[model samples]
Target: MIDYLFRPQLLAVVFVVVLGLLYHRRQPKPSLPDLPWLNTKEGEWFTTLRARFRSTVNYKQSIHQAYDLYSKKNQSCIIGKLNGDEIVLPVSSINWIINQPESVLSADEPHKDVLQTDYTFVHPVVVDKPLHHETIRSELTRQLGALTMDIMDELGSAFDDIWGTNTTEWREICPFETLKLIIARTSNRVFVGLPLCRNKALLEHGIGFATAVPIASSLLKLFPDFLRPLAAVLIARPNRYHTKCFSRLVRPEIERRQKLLEGQNGDLEKKLGDPEPNDFLQWSIRRAQESPYPAERDPDIIAERLLAVNFAAIHTSTFSITNVIFDLVASNPSKKYLEQIREEASSIIAADNGVWTKSGLAKMYKTDSTLRESSRLGSFLGAGLMRQVVAPDGVTAPNGTFCPYGSCVAVPTSGVHNDPEHYPDAATYNPFRFSVERESSTAESPETENDKSNANITEEYIRKANLSFVSTSPTYHPFGHGRHACPGRFFAANELKLLLAYIVLNYEFEPLTERPESKWIGTSLVPPLTATVKVRRRKQNM
Candidate 1:
């Protein structure tokens, strides 16, 4: 009875309506773009209320409906959201939108609003000063090559510890839970290094913090402007606890690094026996030392930044790999896809003398395609490239659609991903779609005489460039698009590929009867949380 009553879909609607009613009288009208609303009688209070209520439950449905009606015609449209309204631009406007200056269309602003960063993150400096992003975009990315072996080591240990070593019998394990554990430990190997990365309390609280932010944000959005501060305190209590837990775990490490930096005299090699740590904590401390604001160098703030990065890395990587695993198991009942992926990975690893290098991972085209296809089919968010209009006068699309200041604008990421025009048979999970195109593009023979012509060479080059999992564009943006796209995507792609490659080569999965259906709460697709996989270890380890 509790399960039936608290199902995500039902609970979302009930929660939205009840809270919305309480704040309805005091809430101000949302400033919107000059576009068609997915709802009817847009100005009528009761009608708008009903539409907003429907949207929480039918957000994906409305996305598709708007796509067919407006996006197909190359026009933008507005859709109701539980928090507010958003203007979803068509594929035609993506380039123009992303090219706009940050002052006009702010990328980070929307995230700050959605995550309720001021409250949930516990320090204004964490969001106000985004050096963490710089750490990821520069230091973390630069060190990925060096960190690969460490991640590989952690991945193996995590798998053995959580999945166990019984090779003879098939074991059933929950994919989501196990993958979350594997991702947290594996990612933290780069974030904080060993011992601390393996701490059970630290990991649990980190996961709790990741889970709490969204819940706290949702609850905070339910209150009127005047009551939000009080509401946020009550709603974000869990996040506060989690933050304290992270601070307790990481404070000692931060202090040790501070001392090392302070006494180094700009020459760390002079330390007789202490080797410089090659991890994110050390990198962040170095980065923060250069900041003009003193708070940016505070130990607690640094710990919060680590928590923020952990939240980003663990949550998204877990979702991505879990979807890939499920898609591989159930998308095709036949063994063909798995066999091909295994062959590609094994051949590449063998060619590299059994070392997993960045260049080596690049050559596993089939493995890359399988993950990309799953991303398209099972996207985590309905929209991408969401931004807030920050200029006082607002901004206008190239097509002359006007989005006023305070309006949230986004592109329908999943809509484009699912469009039949962009992807052939868009609904079916065809894992080899990109690889087949790749093989043909470089093949001696052509599918047709036209394919051999010089006219199509540019098209083939573009297609080849976009085939990698980290690449993003207007039509395919699971990692987002343009200059402001997710900075950690490159590291994430490498980690995911190594994990997938290892799984295919070392274990065998019992073919699932059907792909487990995912649940959609609001615009996010929650992968089958409790879905189980039957697996047996191969006699030889890859």
Candidate 2:
């Protein structure tokens, strides 16, 4: 009988049966391990497949529904399905998951996967390491106080140019397109600075590249990861368009900086020729010189780095501005939210000799909170702090949720942001939620008078709990958390606050429709592609 069981046909049948079972098992449950899967209307396997299919199809509703179901248990570990793969989503284990060393849960790989950033789509010159993030985290952020005037100047010019000065009447316009121009120009002013930012064609390419990176990534991801490398040969085409364009834009600047640096190689503290141009391109060159790469001042390399910064800065800032725009005028006119913000911006700028300051932006807590709350309502991605278990041993969560090696894990950003436990009346848009948090935080943790006077406004705002637009905490994962969190958030905070302050103080907006809902594709939440907000110029100037 044992020999009979080992017959060729019998063994083949068993192999087929086992393969089917394993495939079905990988479909995952819509609930935790110990619990029977919920959403049983379509049967176990069908529910999983349907949800995964809907993930790419009608995404936002599907993920939110699935997450809501799984989160009801408030379990440390819950199983979810995405694109036919079982995922380990931790609700209560956010800190442990996000803070995991890169060895255990690799964040970079997820970005590569999401961005489809292989030689196929991006050139070899495209960054393998996150040098741009380093530049943003350290150099650019430290200079925000100094760059405030530049951003304000850019903000004023970009808004005036994009929103138009002649529209004294309530003219309707799409928020995304309008804000994209405003954000691109405002961001590039600080990014490349001066004449480069003023180039209309260059700014347009920045927008194009920013938009193309994700679209290309999404298209490439349509192919499996293993195939992506091979696919890049045929499907990807290794587009170096942005690299070529931006390289020309900044090559002269980088060459001048290199010459200046060569002359003043003795010490970094020493003033170099032209005061060492304070912009992203210059910073990239300085960092590259510090690194081991031979192509330290290579214009193409510098442009790739610049493109990365533009992509990050323009994409996030535009949507954030749009979201806040919708939220600002969404409420009843009597709530007087817009009026209050106008009053605040006018009062703050009046005191600052009519100039935007890093410190002055800090006092715009209502504006800051509106940005934060808008972000909290609709985070950039549905799942943030994504990681994949890379270690062979695999790691266990703080709450004892274990993920096997090679498993994908992430915090449900949408779920966390909307949790009623964290935000009361979670469904509603409460711009002042974080503002109140700021005030209550101020009262609970009073600083010494000397401490208050000595601390910079940026430091003071961050020191308080719940006030900062860029505050990174376990509860708030919009910018993510820990070391892997968005390194550019400080600059992002300043950019957003200043832009919104300028808008609220200078314009009046009325929504043409209900609060505009963002577009959801897979895990990403894009601000509605088109939201027509009626706008009129405010006659007052700070």
Candidate 3:
């Protein structure tokens, strides 16, 4: 045994193990806030490690426990996480958290850490310069009016091809799996354009990349910083492969656009009688060219940006719509409520001359409310507005809790959405809650009728604005809240609303006897992937 232990390979393995231990020990630990820990006692290193692993599985329960025990009482508490421990602040601190400067409380750091974007995105430049967010926030939003018809066109074709045109019988379909493809295809129609969006290989790779990133990110976080790069080379292989596939696919388009830009002397819009393409690819190319970072301009990185946007859009919309389907069906066991939504959708579409438009989709208030209600009840994350302390000394909450550098702070999003103080009968699913609120606002209220003051105007504006699915507040933040709210929410709202409207108008769905319970995978409240619904094409014409 002594001789075997002296062997060179064995000695080398031991040496590496020692080095790893040392590296992990030297890693900076967050000076977490003075808050009571939920479900775990803070003690020695082993206890903390044990809590972290336990929390990974019990996160859903732990969050609710924290919410009830402390958050509801206006207190903060610490909860263990796979990535690290997080300070779960009360809903009252939401305004305070969002008001802080980015230097002190950074919204981007948590995202970068959680997604492990440095590796998963295929390059650091992708995370460092998130021009895609800006493009989505500005150009895509501005183009929504124009893209509405294109999105609708894709949804119709997607449903026909995937869901079928059979009016004779009801077919069982897995919503999660089917919606993923439909969303990927429909989103890509506006992302790349007609032919490429329909490319079987491209869509597969895009979906593969989206699926791989989260899995890779989760695995990468389990490793120490020193081992992550080496681990990522193996773990993030799928991400790299998909990024390469994306680069190969988009290189031709990038070259073609680059030549066009060069021919027009760096301004495609400036050229006479030539209208620039209106797609995400075009938008990203233009945005990338404006950057000084070489990686940002590289065709490979540009392609990765397209996939990054895909990663953000696909799973989120798919999950949301999946939940909406289950909620819409289960809530109306007799299928009566669906007809009300369908009538709203049909009437709105007919009023818009048989074409879906931004304004027309917006008028489907009941449809919007259904989605909003679903979001409130079935949030993907237990918490929201997550921020990492970046200031050297750390920042203090309005209630005087100190969170040092590296500590993450977030408000209980799911908890707030279900809080009785915020949402009455919070346990029940009320699909038309927001629409009712909107309708009530349009009529004369005591506040609006008796008061013509500026404060009352602001109050009325907020009251009306808060009802929309895209709008976010402390109480309703599936898309997050404050200035850092989801940039793609406007586009997501349009696409989802149109998709829901199309389904309601064109198909007849059999309501579920009971809602399928959603599962919690760490922090994500995942809708059942295998959940199926029966549907048949309606005989009536649109």
Candidate 4:
């Protein structure tokens, strides 16, 4: 009887949902961007729900149609309903929308629904504070020069650990989880410092937390906002588990550092007779100590923030690496893509006495372009850089599309990136696409094919054409653009470049029969988890 009628909990949820539906009209359906609706109608309170369900069914088709319709109609943006709320998804004005003042188009507001961040294990300080981003953009980025060697060392160890003793034959591996493990360890080496990053328990807990977020967020969305607090208690157990693990593994170390601070009367490295830890934990601790808020200084709070950093760093970087690898095998059938990247990396590494430095990573134009192409095609979000309008009057775009207060707005990052207007032959995966293009729009002396035969232009030409992985432009926004662009991008770009260079030089992937397409739902773009590539260690490694 219970099975036929569904569990009591499920039945109760249905009853409450029906009640909420009866009252949902109290919520207003404000003006939209005037784009045509799909399977939609007037006076339908459930348009948002139906739209979301339809989107999930064939998201690529739906998004492509939306992009095309808006483009054909010459609209600035398209209005779409999602999860019972309206959103302004900008098409022509992506750059303008992303750069809008957060006071008007607030970035922090969207996560309340998307990630359920307020109710999850994510610390408010991590989300609200500017310090964490400052740490990434300034302090952590400054240390990357000194930290490169450590990252390379961890990278080698991670490869060995995951790939194992098999060296001779082609061994098929799951690019999905394998790449995550590689990126997780390498990133943690920088975030947590040695030993702990490799600790089975610590890595497990860290990866577990990140892997649990989307699941938790999705569950939280099943309930209406007023009931989410209760639902969060029941459904957010993974977050609780992650919080306990982070506190357990990391809080002790934070306390020890605090004791050291007290023992030395606040001279952390000076009195310890050693250099500072040169890791995120120590960096965060120092910054936390300087915070005006007492909550920011708490050890548990510090652990939560560190986990948040891990969450951001690992998810995007892992997909990026995985996508590029899949593209290397699946997209490049001629295998020239592999040879070019391998040659570039090999030549650079050989010049540096086999040490992959920050400078060395910079010169691999082909490898950098491969990652950029992957990012454009398979970035973490289909439409992101979301902002909520908080202004009493909301705001209007440069194109004069008004986003009302209490409504959400976003840019079609994927649409813009994939558009032929921004990139010629945007549908094709050309590994060296950015390598041949001008590095930036502002660059005065962009090299051209005509420069190829001019010996006088040699180094200058190479320099002009080479695109830095961190460079952001209005058209290319995997990391975003303007003031609020990703701060950790510098670290992320370098990490992935080095990691990819190593893979390119040391292994050859057996191409897949078809291109592995990424899955899209809501705004999230998930990589093909079932994708596999056959690879073998090169003679040098063997």
Candidate 5:
């Protein structure tokens, strides 16, 4: 019987049954530990039932609501039953948890399920050894940094192609589609480079891979823990289809480069001489060679890295760009802000003598502020800076509540960013708030109380002023913190800034909805999916 159970075919079945039994046995029993805050019989009974169900389906929202309730009551941390898991965390404990060393609290585990589902192929790439992560991160930074100019050039051309001058009518369009194309083009410029970026089939595959991975991840989350691994295996082939295409497409190029390097000074020196390769494939091949892994390792590892880059670049850039457009349409006041962005773009272009350089792209401060504000308001995830509890430790919440080890802590970014305490009149949309703050301060001047007051001048401003920028410590994270903060943030910002600048310079927009409210589902805040927006080319005064 033991031998039969150990067989590969029976192993998964047996494991599933054993896990289900364990889950059943571990289900919270009656006469649960008393939770101090639940004074009402109804509240206590509901809490007990929630513990028995062991579901996190509505847990995130419930946690937020609980924070508001208990926070007002002068309570810092609240112990609640989420699905079946016991959660004892303070609303203010994020800073403490994030500041702890990775050895004490690892981000690797909390995000493991999500990462494993959406990024199975790349798991080996990141977790194989320390060198793998370093190689990919370092190479990606170098490749993206060098490709900034190419990205800007492509943005200009792509803008003209999609919403060109000859089109006179203001048509209702999907911002997601427009942003999707822009991201696909820019990402492909780096991923495969040049001619392939223009290939419709390949571009479709790239976009499909980006969309599918997230959907797969969400679906995988619903299954039992043991079955998730099997589900990943079932879904991985579809995900790998794109990887297979990438490898086949780039293998010949890799071979040609290999020959050139072998014939001359050898591959290593050749790659080092021009370390900043425009093509991600070349960059990956060079880095893989330099990696500690033996050459005998499968070449698919390089393909996996390329796929990982595609996954990172496409979805994030697309979602952010879509959100910006949503805000533009929903908040019609954004038209004036768009015009300001246009003027900045026009000035930069003329100053550069009509040359689009990386420095010129960097000068679009208004565009940057607009994109940043949009991200602030239209944040895709509710929780910011997620870290897993590796070993237990004591964490003191901002409100002075204490949490023991093995507790997950998250920054209530939406709460912090939207709070009236930090930002007076917090609900109003002010696209230029950051720009105004920057303008008020000088290069060498210390931030005085007066300047800080101006920084939080409005009720809304006050709320957000105290909220951490990306440069702030891990506690106040929007793009995360520490070394693991989104490495592609600079690149993502540039792409969105350029795209928005082009649209503002070339087009005019009017909202379909009189008063558009962005929809918040789970942690993501999305603008109206089908909202109509009228657009037409800007009339030139010669």
Candidate 6:
């Protein structure tokens, strides 16, 4: 019998049986590691895996459904195994991770590989050793305030020109095209300043830079880390294009300024600051001398940073603006919303001696509410406040469940924003929600008037609102959270508000389709591509 078992056929059969046993043993044995109170069945393991696969097809859709399940079950946390090694911790568990300090549960690990790709130009700057995060943050904060104030006239004028009453019929326009022009002009005005803003070749390069960098960065990300630097060099065309544009269009002006500074006495140069060193280039140059990465302070580097800002500003702003337009066109109720915003803008413009200031912008609370409402429903990100678990730690939710490291966690922003708990009858679009909250808060605490006012309408308010979703605190974050939250968001919010205000006040918009829903791919949510809207220029009563 022993001799027969050693035979080829017999050996083969025994080998197969042994392998099957080993494979079965290796298969993950799912357990309710977090649910100390409730016993979960073995079938739940398979259910979790199946759901994970389905959810992987489109994370946003799955997240929305997961929140609905969470709401119905009245559960703060749920646990599911994704494939063999991965796990799905409910939104609450993810929140716990976000709440923890950088020392305890670092975002550095999880997001390291996620953002290292070529598609993200700022990734290198962010991950580089010598570049201080605080320094960059401070500089950016100062730069944004100055930049926003400086470009108001140009931005306002661009709005007037693009949507001006000169055209009789509203031609079929590409929202992307219209938005690109606005973004390029606004960005150029701040980046290189005037004359270059009017440079046709430079503008074309700026527009193309937005599309190319993201594409290349995305491609670069898909490769291994060791290969990224090499890959960036390989995909150098966009960088080259940017360099060429900067060299040709911006370099001469910078050199002239440099010459002027060299010739002038210290006092005169300090007083004049190169006659007009008023844009991002000048700002970056001034700060770059103090930076460890002095090479990044170069005109090319300034161009790249400007390009990065544009990357952050353009698509997000356009998508948001387009969504608002879509929403206004689709909903019958939106006519009043549009009218309300127009009246607010008219009043503010009239009150401000025909000027739009930071204070004047604040008075358009209704418009702010409308945009906030639109973000609540039409937010494009699949998961808000996403973070990759870096440290070898676990997040224990309100239910005492722990989500381990290596897990990608996010706040169910769509869930929270649409949650009846937060916003009553959350599906309905209500512009008055924020405004009402502001009034109630003001009445309750008069001393907190400044707090309440700033809470509702400031750029910081919007940034905080978007970050709140991803934050452990759980307010409403459509953008993200923590130290790494979007820096260009202030500019994006103001740009969208101004553009929408301009349109609502001057044009009557009618959508060709009924309310259109957004389409989700993985974590990306894109609004309906081809919703036709008719625009009729409003007659000036004056």
| Top-scoring candidate (lDDT) | 3
Worst 10 residues of 3 by lDDT: 1-10
TM-score per prediction, in order, is: 0.91, 0.85, 0.91, 0.88, 0.78, 0.74
Listed per candidate, the RMSD to the true structure in angstroms reads: 5.5, 9.0, 5.8, 5.3, 7.4, 10.4
Query: Candidate 3, residues 241-274: lDDT per residue as tens digits?
Result: 8888877987898888877787555777776357
Tell me the tens digit of each residue's lDDT in model 4 across 401-423: 77788777665567777889778
lDDT on C-alpha atoms for all candidate structures: 0.82, 0.70, 0.84, 0.74, 0.58, 0.57
RMSD of 6: 10.4
lDDT of 6 at 40: 30
Better of 2 and 4 by lDDT: 4
Model 2 worst lDDT window (10 residues): 30-39
Against the true structure, candidate 6 reaches a TM-score of 0.74
For residues 330-359, what per-residue lDDT tens digits would candidate 5 score against the true structure? 665635766676788889878988765656
Residue 199, candidate 4: C-alpha displacement in angstroms: 1.3
Error of 5 at 30 (Å): 18
| Tens-place lDDT digits, model 1, residues 1-542 | 11232346544544544565656676665467556777657467787667877877887888888778887778888888768788887778889888999999999899988888888888867887778998999888887778878988998899899987778999999999999999999888898997899999899888888988888787677666555666665567788888998899989989877876786574455663567888999888888888888878889999999899889988888888888888888855555788899899889989989888877876778888888988888889888889899998888787778889888888877788999999989988888888876756762323355876755557656668577688898889888789988999988988999999988888888989788988888888878889999988888778
Candidate 6's residue-wise lDDT over 361-411, tens digit each?
655667777777777888776555655445565554464545565554455
Q: Residue 32 CA error for candidate 2 (Å)? A: 13
The TM-score measured for candidate 2 stands at: 0.85
